[model samples]
Target: MSINIINRSGHPLPAYQTAHAAGMDVYAHLPAEPVTLGPLQRALIPTGLFLEIPEGYEAQVRPRSGLAYRHGIGIVNSPGTIDADYRGELKVLLVNLSDTDFVVQDGERIAQLVVARHERVAWQAAEELSETQRGAGGYGSTGTK
Candidate 1:
Protein backbone atom coordinates (compact mmCIF):
# COMPACT_ATOMS: atom_id res chain seq x y z
CA MET A 1 0.00 0.00 0.00
CA SER A 2 1.61 3.18 -1.19
CA ILE A 3 0.48 6.29 0.65
CA ASN A 4 0.94 9.83 -0.61
CA ILE A 5 2.33 12.07 2.10
CA ILE A 6 3.48 15.68 2.35
CA ASN A 7 6.05 16.49 4.99
CA ARG A 8 6.28 20.16 5.83
CA SER A 9 8.54 19.72 8.79
CA GLY A 10 12.32 20.11 8.82
CA HIS A 11 12.83 16.46 9.68
CA PRO A 12 12.75 13.49 7.39
CA LEU A 13 9.77 11.29 6.69
CA PRO A 14 8.64 8.77 9.28
CA ALA A 15 10.07 5.31 8.77
CA TYR A 16 10.35 1.98 10.49
CA GLN A 17 13.74 1.37 12.04
CA THR A 18 13.68 -2.39 11.74
CA ALA A 19 12.14 -5.03 9.58
CA HIS A 20 8.74 -6.39 10.62
CA ALA A 21 8.01 -3.33 12.70
CA ALA A 22 4.34 -2.63 12.93
CA GLY A 23 4.58 1.17 13.14
CA MET A 24 6.81 4.03 11.98
CA ASP A 25 8.37 6.47 14.36
CA VAL A 26 6.69 9.88 14.13
CA TYR A 27 8.75 12.96 14.86
CA ALA A 28 7.90 16.16 16.71
CA HIS A 29 8.11 19.32 14.63
CA LEU A 30 9.18 22.17 16.83
CA PRO A 31 10.91 25.20 15.32
CA ALA A 32 12.00 26.86 18.53
CA GLU A 33 13.09 25.79 21.97
CA PRO A 34 11.79 22.51 23.31
CA VAL A 35 8.42 22.49 24.97
CA THR A 36 8.31 21.52 28.62
CA LEU A 37 5.38 19.60 30.01
CA GLY A 38 5.03 19.65 33.76
CA PRO A 39 3.65 16.79 35.73
CA LEU A 40 0.29 15.64 34.33
CA GLN A 41 0.47 18.31 31.62
CA ARG A 42 -0.83 17.60 28.17
CA ALA A 43 0.12 19.23 24.88
CA LEU A 44 -0.61 18.80 21.21
CA ILE A 45 2.63 18.26 19.32
CA PRO A 46 2.42 18.92 15.62
CA THR A 47 4.13 16.84 12.96
CA GLY A 48 3.65 19.19 10.01
CA LEU A 49 2.61 16.20 7.96
CA PHE A 50 -0.40 15.59 5.78
CA LEU A 51 -1.48 12.35 4.26
CA GLU A 52 -3.72 11.26 1.42
CA ILE A 53 -4.86 7.98 2.84
CA PRO A 54 -6.68 5.58 0.62
CA GLU A 55 -10.22 4.51 1.30
CA GLY A 56 -10.85 1.62 3.71
CA TYR A 57 -7.73 2.46 5.67
CA GLU A 58 -6.70 4.62 8.63
CA ALA A 59 -3.58 6.00 10.24
CA GLN A 60 -3.34 5.48 13.96
CA VAL A 61 -1.27 7.70 16.21
CA ARG A 62 0.06 5.64 19.10
CA PRO A 63 2.37 6.12 22.07
CA ARG A 64 6.05 5.19 21.93
CA SER A 65 6.63 2.50 24.52
CA GLY A 66 10.20 3.66 25.06
CA LEU A 67 9.10 7.18 25.93
CA ALA A 68 6.37 5.88 28.15
CA TYR A 69 8.81 3.67 30.00
CA ARG A 70 11.71 6.11 30.21
CA HIS A 71 10.10 9.51 30.73
CA GLY A 72 6.53 8.51 31.42
CA ILE A 73 5.42 10.31 28.25
CA GLY A 74 2.59 8.96 26.18
CA ILE A 75 -0.12 9.99 23.81
CA VAL A 76 -3.30 11.11 25.53
CA ASN A 77 -5.43 9.46 22.88
CA SER A 78 -3.28 6.46 22.07
CA PRO A 79 -4.17 4.93 18.75
CA GLY A 80 -5.95 8.08 17.61
CA THR A 81 -7.58 7.38 14.30
CA ILE A 82 -7.07 9.54 11.23
CA ASP A 83 -9.90 8.88 8.87
CA ALA A 84 -9.28 8.51 5.18
CA ASP A 85 -10.82 11.87 4.40
CA TYR A 86 -8.87 13.86 6.97
CA ARG A 87 -6.34 16.17 5.28
CA GLY A 88 -5.16 18.33 8.15
CA GLU A 89 -1.71 18.33 9.66
CA LEU A 90 -0.92 15.47 11.99
CA LYS A 91 -0.64 16.40 15.62
CA VAL A 92 -0.16 14.20 18.63
CA LEU A 93 -1.85 14.72 21.97
CA LEU A 94 1.00 14.06 24.37
CA VAL A 95 0.74 13.82 28.15
CA ASN A 96 3.42 13.78 30.80
CA LEU A 97 2.42 10.94 33.03
CA SER A 98 5.40 11.26 35.37
CA ASP A 99 5.91 13.54 38.35
CA THR A 100 8.72 15.44 36.60
CA ASP A 101 8.79 17.67 33.59
CA PHE A 102 9.21 16.09 30.17
CA VAL A 103 10.87 18.09 27.42
CA VAL A 104 9.67 17.65 23.88
CA GLN A 105 12.50 18.50 21.50
CA ASP A 106 12.50 19.15 17.80
CA GLY A 107 12.71 15.95 15.76
CA GLU A 108 11.90 13.95 18.86
CA ARG A 109 10.24 10.61 18.19
CA ILE A 110 7.16 11.28 20.26
CA ALA A 111 4.82 8.73 18.83
CA GLN A 112 4.27 5.99 16.26
CA LEU A 113 2.06 5.87 13.18
CA VAL A 114 0.40 2.66 12.19
CA VAL A 115 -1.41 2.38 8.88
CA ALA A 116 -3.96 -0.38 8.99
CA ARG A 117 -6.90 -1.66 7.03
CA HIS A 118 -10.29 -1.67 8.72
CA GLU A 119 -13.70 -2.95 7.83
CA ARG A 120 -16.98 -1.09 7.70
CA VAL A 121 -19.70 -2.98 9.48
CA ALA A 122 -23.35 -3.08 8.55
CA TRP A 123 -25.90 -3.80 11.24
CA GLN A 124 -28.20 -6.72 10.53
CA ALA A 125 -30.87 -5.45 12.95
CA ALA A 126 -31.02 -8.71 14.81
CA GLU A 127 -32.38 -8.92 18.35
CA GLU A 128 -30.19 -11.89 19.22
CA LEU A 129 -26.61 -12.96 18.79
CA SER A 130 -25.18 -16.47 19.04
CA GLU A 131 -24.22 -17.42 22.57
CA THR A 132 -20.96 -18.90 23.72
CA GLN A 133 -19.93 -20.82 26.80
CA ARG A 134 -18.78 -17.56 28.41
CA GLY A 135 -21.47 -15.44 26.85
CA ALA A 136 -21.89 -11.90 28.22
CA GLY A 137 -18.92 -12.29 30.51
CA GLY A 138 -16.97 -9.01 30.68
CA TYR A 139 -14.09 -7.20 32.36
CA GLY A 140 -12.14 -9.65 34.48
CA SER A 141 -14.60 -12.50 34.06
CA THR A 142 -12.21 -14.45 31.85
CA GLY A 143 -9.10 -13.54 33.78
CA THR A 144 -7.46 -15.68 36.42
CA LYS A 145 -9.17 -15.38 39.79
Candidate 2:
Protein backbone atom coordinates (compact mmCIF):
# COMPACT_ATOMS: atom_id res chain seq x y z
CA MET A 1 0.00 0.00 0.00
CA SER A 2 1.09 3.52 -0.77
CA ILE A 3 1.06 6.21 1.95
CA ASN A 4 0.58 9.89 1.11
CA ILE A 5 3.11 12.40 2.45
CA ILE A 6 2.67 16.16 2.39
CA ASN A 7 5.64 18.43 2.24
CA ARG A 8 4.57 21.60 3.99
CA SER A 9 7.58 23.52 2.71
CA GLY A 10 6.60 22.86 -0.90
CA HIS A 11 9.92 21.22 -1.65
CA PRO A 12 11.02 17.67 -2.24
CA LEU A 13 13.34 15.94 0.21
CA PRO A 14 15.55 12.97 -0.51
CA ALA A 15 14.34 9.55 0.55
CA TYR A 16 17.24 7.40 1.77
CA GLN A 17 17.78 3.69 2.23
CA THR A 18 20.81 2.25 4.00
CA ALA A 19 20.51 -1.26 2.64
CA HIS A 20 18.35 -3.33 0.37
CA ALA A 21 16.68 -5.33 3.13
CA ALA A 22 15.58 -2.40 5.24
CA GLY A 23 11.91 -2.17 6.11
CA MET A 24 11.55 1.61 6.48
CA ASP A 25 12.72 4.46 4.29
CA VAL A 26 14.78 7.36 5.67
CA TYR A 27 13.48 10.79 4.75
CA ALA A 28 15.76 13.78 4.45
CA HIS A 29 15.20 17.52 4.84
CA LEU A 30 14.57 19.83 1.93
CA PRO A 31 16.67 22.59 3.47
CA ALA A 32 18.69 20.70 5.99
CA GLU A 33 20.52 22.23 8.94
CA PRO A 34 23.05 21.02 11.47
CA VAL A 35 21.71 20.08 14.93
CA THR A 36 24.11 19.80 17.86
CA LEU A 37 22.99 17.64 20.76
CA GLY A 38 24.94 17.81 24.02
CA PRO A 39 25.61 14.99 26.40
CA LEU A 40 22.43 13.52 27.84
CA GLN A 41 20.52 16.27 26.11
CA ARG A 42 17.24 15.96 24.26
CA ALA A 43 15.99 17.81 21.19
CA LEU A 44 12.92 17.78 18.97
CA ILE A 45 14.09 17.34 15.37
CA PRO A 46 11.73 18.30 12.62
CA THR A 47 11.42 16.46 9.32
CA GLY A 48 9.89 19.48 7.51
CA LEU A 49 7.01 17.28 6.42
CA PHE A 50 3.59 16.03 7.40
CA LEU A 51 1.69 12.83 6.73
CA GLU A 52 -1.88 11.76 6.10
CA ILE A 53 -2.04 8.21 7.39
CA PRO A 54 -5.04 6.10 6.56
CA GLU A 55 -7.61 5.46 9.26
CA GLY A 56 -7.09 2.45 11.58
CA TYR A 57 -3.31 2.77 11.20
CA GLU A 58 -0.64 4.68 13.10
CA ALA A 59 2.94 5.76 12.54
CA GLN A 60 5.72 4.71 14.89
CA VAL A 61 8.82 6.86 15.28
CA ARG A 62 11.91 4.83 16.08
CA PRO A 63 15.70 5.16 16.25
CA ARG A 64 18.25 4.02 13.76
CA SER A 65 20.09 0.95 14.96
CA GLY A 66 23.45 2.12 13.61
CA LEU A 67 23.23 5.44 15.44
CA ALA A 68 22.05 3.90 18.68
CA TYR A 69 24.74 1.23 18.78
CA ARG A 70 27.63 3.35 17.52
CA HIS A 71 27.02 6.81 18.99
CA GLY A 72 24.64 5.98 21.81
CA ILE A 73 22.04 8.35 20.44
CA GLY A 74 18.48 7.09 20.34
CA ILE A 75 14.87 8.11 20.71
CA VAL A 76 13.72 8.56 24.30
CA ASN A 77 10.37 7.01 23.55
CA SER A 78 11.71 4.00 21.67
CA PRO A 79 8.60 3.62 19.54
CA GLY A 80 6.75 6.93 19.64
CA THR A 81 3.17 6.55 18.48
CA ILE A 82 1.42 8.87 16.05
CA ASP A 83 -2.30 8.35 15.99
CA ALA A 84 -4.21 8.24 12.73
CA ASP A 85 -6.51 11.11 13.74
CA TYR A 86 -3.59 13.49 14.20
CA ARG A 87 -3.15 16.01 11.42
CA GLY A 88 0.02 17.69 12.62
CA GLU A 89 3.66 17.88 11.71
CA LEU A 90 5.82 14.88 12.52
CA LYS A 91 8.85 15.56 14.69
CA VAL A 92 11.40 13.22 16.18
CA LEU A 93 12.45 13.43 19.83
CA LEU A 94 16.10 12.38 20.05
CA VAL A 95 18.34 12.05 23.08
CA ASN A 96 22.13 11.98 23.12
CA LEU A 97 23.53 9.33 25.44
CA SER A 98 27.19 9.79 24.60
CA ASP A 99 29.60 11.91 26.55
CA THR A 100 30.58 14.15 23.66
CA ASP A 101 28.50 16.22 21.30
CA PHE A 102 26.71 14.70 18.36
CA VAL A 103 25.89 16.52 15.16
CA VAL A 104 22.89 15.92 12.92
CA GLN A 105 23.67 17.18 9.48
CA ASP A 106 21.25 18.29 6.81
CA GLY A 107 19.70 15.51 4.69
CA GLU A 108 20.92 12.88 7.10
CA ARG A 109 18.91 9.84 8.11
CA ILE A 110 18.27 10.35 11.81
CA ALA A 111 15.27 8.14 12.51
CA GLN A 112 12.79 5.74 10.99
CA LEU A 113 9.02 5.90 10.76
CA VAL A 114 7.00 2.69 10.57
CA VAL A 115 3.26 2.56 9.93
CA ALA A 116 1.46 0.06 12.16
CA ARG A 117 -1.98 -0.98 13.28
CA HIS A 118 -3.21 -0.30 16.80
CA GLU A 119 -5.74 -2.37 18.67
CA ARG A 120 -8.46 -0.46 20.47
CA VAL A 121 -9.77 -1.56 23.83
CA ALA A 122 -13.23 -1.19 25.34
CA TRP A 123 -13.22 -0.48 29.07
CA GLN A 124 -15.81 -1.95 31.36
CA ALA A 125 -16.25 -1.56 35.11
CA ALA A 126 -16.13 -4.91 36.85
CA GLU A 127 -15.66 -6.08 40.43
CA GLU A 128 -13.06 -8.75 39.61
CA LEU A 129 -10.94 -10.02 36.76
CA SER A 130 -9.91 -13.53 35.80
CA GLU A 131 -7.25 -14.91 38.14
CA THR A 132 -4.01 -16.51 36.98
CA GLN A 133 -1.22 -18.61 38.50
CA ARG A 134 1.14 -15.66 38.67
CA GLY A 135 -1.37 -13.04 39.70
CA ALA A 136 0.14 -9.80 40.99
CA GLY A 137 3.69 -11.10 40.81
CA GLY A 138 5.81 -7.98 40.81
CA TYR A 139 8.82 -7.30 38.59
CA GLY A 140 11.37 -10.10 37.99
CA SER A 141 9.33 -12.66 39.94
CA THR A 142 9.37 -15.22 37.14
CA GLY A 143 13.09 -16.15 37.07
CA THR A 144 16.54 -15.06 36.02
CA LYS A 145 19.05 -16.52 33.61
Top TM-score model: 1
Q: Compute the lDDT for candidate 2.
A: 0.76
Per-residue lDDT for 31-121 in model 2, tens only? 5567889999988877777777888888888888889999988999978888877778778888999999998765667787777877888
Report the error of model 2 at residue 9, Å: 7.3
* Model 1 misplaced regions, further than 4 Å: none
* Count of clashing pairs, candidate 1: 0
Q: List the residue pairs that clash in candidate 1.
A: none
User: What is the per-residue lDDT of model 1 for residues 2-35, given as tens digits with 9 covering 90 to 100?
Assistant: 9999999979898998999999999999987789
* Whole-model lDDT values for every prediction: 0.93, 0.76
In candidate 2, clashing pairs total 0
